[model samples]
Target: MNSRLQHLLEQWSNDQFTEADKQELIEMLRSASAEREIIPVLQDMWEKTEDEGLFSEEHQQTIIKNILDRYPAGELPDKKEIVPTMYAIHRTHFIRRWRWAVASSVALIIGIGAYYWYQHMQGKRPVDMVQSTTRVQPGQNGALLTLSNGSQVLLDTLQNGRIVLQGGVVARIRNGILLYEGTGSEVQYNTISTPKGRQFQLQLSDGTNVWLNAESSIRYPVTFAGNERLVRIIGEVFLEVAQNPSIPFRVDVNGSTWLEVLGTSFNVNAYENEGAIRTTLQEGSLRVVGDRFNGHLQKVLSPGQQALTTKGNADIRVFDDVNAASVTAWKDGVFDFNNVPLEEAMRQLARWYDIEVVYQQPVPKVQLGGTIKRSLPFADVLYFLGKVGLHYKLEGNRRLIVLP
Candidate 1:
């Protein structure tokens, strides 16, 4: 065993390891031979400590299966080679001393090792050998605000203060939140649009809270003046409509779909590339209407129900028992991939990273299942995807070419 690896292991066993030491230990264990040696040590440590019931046997098996199933048939490493790595990756994290943090670090090591091992089996250059000159950071809180007078303000760069719009309507930005104050009778409209790699939060004049996802926009009146409060949105938005039984709130999505909210919380995904508009109701009831090219369709959704409207189709499909948390995970700073298709996952990445994805070959038929933090760097995100047998190459700073 390497002296440094031994010292790190001692620190970890004694619960004295710093984060950097833990990371270094993970990197060192990337060697297959080292993995074999570390497995026994991890098992011994686990055996000495009483099981804390952190992860059940069924859950552990499921996680192991999820990782192993990423490889194609007959291409997987030998069972002897894989079992030890899996044990090391899965069991070490369960040590009562460093449960969650150690799990993340160990899982990353396994992902990196699997990616390199697959590349070796295919006679391709390892990931480290690839030339990547650019580092893309995660998206930030920012958007472009279009005033009623056709003037635009870059919210990311603007100072936090009160801004008087047309007719003396005041908008304030404090701690990165846009809040509208006072009331107006003229019903002037303002639009907040988030470009790729950006998101923003806004409190409408009616006290409704709106969260704009990447490449999304919401246009609404400066204040609620009439009996009906109406807004138009593009891309995706999660809204918590303020309760007002007298006035109904309506959302016009890209001029194709309409959502009526009677004080409900829901999310709308209407990206053109997605081929369908998905509205997942989180709380309260929502009425969704789809205006297709041929006909019109509508559906009333209950809480936890999702309505899907295909573009150019006249039918509105409602799915029951939908995962509302997974649907609005982005708003909560997570990328939920539970049963998400590969193309859809890539689209999320493209939007958040502000990069274009091009397929050099046929798109891989894969379903990803996991949750990753949206705060991770672009490179780390790609590394996590490698656990699913996905390969890619970054060209220049903005293009991600998917490999077969």
Candidate 2:
């Protein structure tokens, strides 16, 4: 494929292909159809993308060439979307402009690749790398905090920097989590909330720790007082309860589900898009509760065990797994691709690096697995994947198009 032609095709797939350029594509398709085959591999690519993968950039070129060699001889139709692109990603912050940006990024990146595949595979184009936007953006990253006295605070902004004492208290942000330390007779309560696509953590005065996941929140006091410690939440969280046999700890979520513990460690996952609320116990023992069902308690679990609660449906299921590494991979800074779907893997990529994903054809059902440096540039990551057999082409400098 001619390098310029290939770049243009990728840009087309990205929706970055302008109207005038599209007219050119129509002309090329019409002429090529009479002398060469233009069988698109988007359908094939979508079916098993998760199970199988492309080996390298060279292999991708080969696939492109093979497809181009298969187009039937005829004058092609002028400019109707012959190839299908999966624009199915939804529920993303529900904002119009962001969605458009996301859509544009995906369309241009993927469209260019699809169009290039059509022309080049037939010996009409060349393969020279082009640059476009591959850095897709994930949703919001903010937190809503509520104090014990029914007061609220937003933590997303850099307000005075140090959240030390309001009246002689000391607060710290360590390991990306907030913590408070101070000696005072009055114990003030506080809450922390995270918006969709965001996460935050905190450490309480009594040494009980908590981590708030995306679209979730937690309510606690500045200091642990009275006979026991109590807190409430509506989303996902992880807790490391301070060992206090005399004073039990409790967590209230979903207006019904509850957990009690003395000294233990566990995690919770209750994102809105996801249907279940899961608590994976890493150490110690805890009790589960629910409001939907009268007898809605789960079995006690040992280390490496978990409890799950479904939305609207009130039934807790206990599952056992000893691989703590898999559960805690995100926290430890590793992109764990353990048999993940093409869409899901791309979604994670979009979130961490702030980029968008667009499929020129349908998404393949191949399962991808591996770990890589999350900080690597999008091109380097794609290049590595191409070396591993995934076919793709870049346009401009931002879009990532999925090739068949």
> All models: lDDT?
0.76, 0.58
C-alpha RMSD values across all candidates: 6.7, 16.4
User: Model 2: per-residue lDDT, tens digit, 1-404?
Assistant: 23444455456434475657666655654564511322222222233233233333353334333332222112122223322222222111212222223223233334445555545544632334422332332333356766555666677654334664555776765545577877656877677877644666678888887776556778776777888788878666778899989988988766657777889988776655446777788889888775525654555667887777776656778877746666655555455677656776676665555455688776655567655544344545674466456776665444567786
RMSD score of candidate 2 (Å): 16.4
| Candidate 1 per-residue C-alpha lDDT over 292-399 given as tens digits, one digit per residue, 9 for 90 to 100 | 233346789999999988766657899999999999999988889998989999999899989899997788876788777776667566767776788877777778
TM-score, per-candidate, Cα-based: 0.72, 0.55
Provide the global lDDT of candidate 2 against the true structure.
0.58
Quick one: best lDDT, which candidate? 1
Error of 2 at 252 (Å): 2.5
User: Could you say which candidate leads in TM-score?
Assistant: 1
Question: Candidate 2: how many backbone clashes?
Answer: 61
Q: Which 10-residue span in candidate 1 carries the lowest summed lDDT? A: 67-76
